[model samples]
Target: MKNSEPIIKVDHLFYRYEKENVLEDISIEVPKGAFLGIVGPNGSGKSTLLKHLLGLLKIQQGKIQLFGTEIRSFKDWDRIGFVSQKANSFNTGFPATVYEVVLSGLTRKIGLFRFGSREDRKKVDHILESVGMLDFKNRNIGELSGGQQQRVFIARALVSEPDLLILDEPTVGVDAQNVNQFYDMLENLNKELHITLVLVTHDIGVISDKVTHVACLNKNLHFHGSTFEFNALKERDLSSIYGHDVQVITHHH
Candidate 1:
């Protein structure tokens, strides 16, 4: 039962910084419940296009609608949860506990004059449990390793219970072992929690294996389809997009 409705739609999207153009004539569509991955080289407008989806950058040439509604300030802003790569790049010495940081996402629906209600705290607990970070909840964020901190941020993102979750290089600072675990975690979120994931990353080796669909962007959008279609692309084509001799090992289910 494929639905024609889209969770995100971008038509003829473009963004310019003063005199320089970052994205040109870009168009993309993310259908409901799809795990979509964006891959491209550095300075190839990957993050810029992601900002458009988040509404961090305004549309200079086109329209973007999220969840069937136009990109408006009040309605669409809080509905999406963003976990950026910079979150890991942060100095861990920031004096907050992991529990405190994850609990912050509850601010979305929390009312005035109250930090977080009892129900909010309970919801935070549930999200932490889902992300398998319950025991680390009381630990200081700085004391934990990079992988643990990423899990905390993921818990924070899910605390809001968003229908759409956008991750910008979620595996940027982690080790290979943890990176696999991160993708596995996201795969669990997609299957068990059923959250629609849109991720911007340069690591095609990792995302190419996990995502349901791939969107290759290079100042202009190029390809959009199932990962199977991407797997069908020639090695030369893959190397061209990645700018390297890339190889992938996939398992048939």
Candidate 2:
């Protein structure tokens, strides 16, 4: 009952691969418990605007909607939860265990030829005890580390209880003290399971203060909003959204 709409509602977002223009005129909305935080730099388009908001790229000229439909009739793909960035390069000696890789994220909600019940192994043991990895479930997902296999692929993208998760660089190879305890377990799963985060990072000072919104792409949309108005901008507008010389340092724990 916490959805006050706008769980992502881009507009005018243009993408192009055949002739450059990765993402120009991109607009964003987010709302519904947003955590946002999508900085930029390396080739700008921030994973091509998160693969055009997870439809894996198609909307070539504009409008996206997601939780309010219209991402080409967004069929509620298990209410969205994607982890990507090679989601821990599997085939780890082909053995699989951390509770069969977080119960294989419920194979797209329990239907990969149907199996999971015991209430889907108690919802993959309560999402591997909310990503502490439930005491390493049964270990051996190639032995853990790399922040415990990225908290077992974020408990396999939160065992399908997704209400918009979408991570990309998720502390890419973790460890600067586990990337500050993996963004403090993604701010305790966005303030204790309210979800709706959209992180894509180049570590803008480790999500500045655990994000509350702050987009600043490069190919376009050079800044969005809040996180106290993107920390009152201008370190030369974050060094012109990372074309060079960015020196923002505001971490006061």
Candidate 3:
């Protein structure tokens, strides 16, 4: 891919479930090294757009390109890591250690019938360390706090060393203190590892200061620009995006 190409590109996108339109003529671009945050009220097509970008949902209208290739033809699945909102609900009672959970990320590369090699184990350890969960490597996944479990899931996503990481409401069950720490960890990953991040969040205030770019969506994209521009927008403009009276409050750590 060229250095100037966007990591994700969407043009004139539209999606419908049954007969109801969830997304309408959406167009956006996420460039390399971008910490892009997609924020909107509930049922505003935030997750729907994310699903389209990840190729989890069929595109009925418009075009989407990932890493300079059309979404339909993009074959480099290993280059992208995804952590869904339902990650926290994964069989918490299952008999799996943190190490085992993260190691599973390589199942596609290591093969289902085979075991991870020494180098694979090293990679898992390194990823867990990066997420600050190495100390809990041997603990049961079900025993950790919500934030710790989320970090483990992130480690699992990173074990494959993806170039792009997409997270959907990853901070759902995390407490206030851990939520801040979680975003800090993501920022470190973006800056130090150079992994492009696409985060879907409903709490715009928490992520506004952490992201490099912001896109507000409600059936259509209301705003797409630098974080500075997004922050400078008046409440009236933001209210329009929510389709109701609203206020945006940004928090900085």
Candidate 4:
């Protein structure tokens, strides 16, 4: 990717679900390797914007570019890692082992017809270790706490070693202690691995501390810029996006 251009760019994008218009002319330029937090109230189309980035929902108007080329036309999706709220919500009684869950990410590299080769297993092992889950590799999914389960999901997401990672509500089920740990892990990934991260979250407390950029959306995007912009905005602006009175307690980064 060129240094001058955004890694992910959305231009005047519009979308409608059934009869209601969901997103209206949203545009953003996310520079390479930025930790971007997308925040808004419920039903504000935050997740819809993420879907547009992932190419799951097609844009009815304007354009979306991943590394300058249109996202809809890009074929090498393996370079992007996504861990939705569904991955952690899998049936615990199904008896999928931890290693198996993490190794599932290798499916793309192993191809459809062939089973996982020795190299794929080796890669899974490395990823499991990187995510600090090597010791629990054989444990059943049902046995793990929410934090452990989230780490396993992250390992699965990292098994592909994607250049960009998009996490939708990664800390929802996790406890406060592990939420901090997860945020620490993300910071390490962003600083050490230099992976671009786009996070969808409502936990403004944690995000304000770690994320450098922010985007506010309400069925339609309202703001996209540095976190400092959020700091400068009046309390009324925060209330406007939240659709109610919001208490924005800030801190030093």
| Most lDDT-accurate candidate | 3
The number of the candidate with the highest TM-score is 3
Q: In model 4, which regions exceed 4 Å deviation?
A: 112-118, 249-253
lDDT of 2: 0.81
lDDT of 2 by residue, 99-151 (tens): 87778888866766555889988889888888777888887887776777877
What lDDT does candidate 4 reach at residue 7?
A: 84
lDDT of 1 at 132: 82
Better of 1 and 3 by TM-score: 3
Clashes by residue pair, model 3: none
Instruction: Report backbone clashes per prediction.
Output: 0, 0, 0, 1
Give candidate 3's TM-score. Answer: 0.96
* Residues 1-253, model 3: lDDT tens digits: 8889999999999999999999999999999999999999999999899888888899999999999999999999899999886545767797989999899999999987466999998999899999999999999998898889989999999999999999999998888878888999998999999999999998878656789999899999899999999888888988888888877676666
> Which residue runs does candidate 1 get wrong by more than 4 Å?
1-3, 72-74, 111-115, 249-253
Tell me the TM-score of model 1. 0.90
Q: Cα lDDT of all candidates, in order?
A: 0.81, 0.81, 0.90, 0.83
TM-score of 4: 0.91
Query: Root-mean-square deviation of each candidate, in angstroms?
Result: 2.6, 15.1, 1.4, 2.3
Relative to the true structure, candidate 2 reaches a TM of 0.34
What would the per-residue lDDT of candidate 4 be over residues 69-149, giving only the tens digit for each residue?
A: 888789878888998875357676867888888878887777654548788888888878877789999899778877788
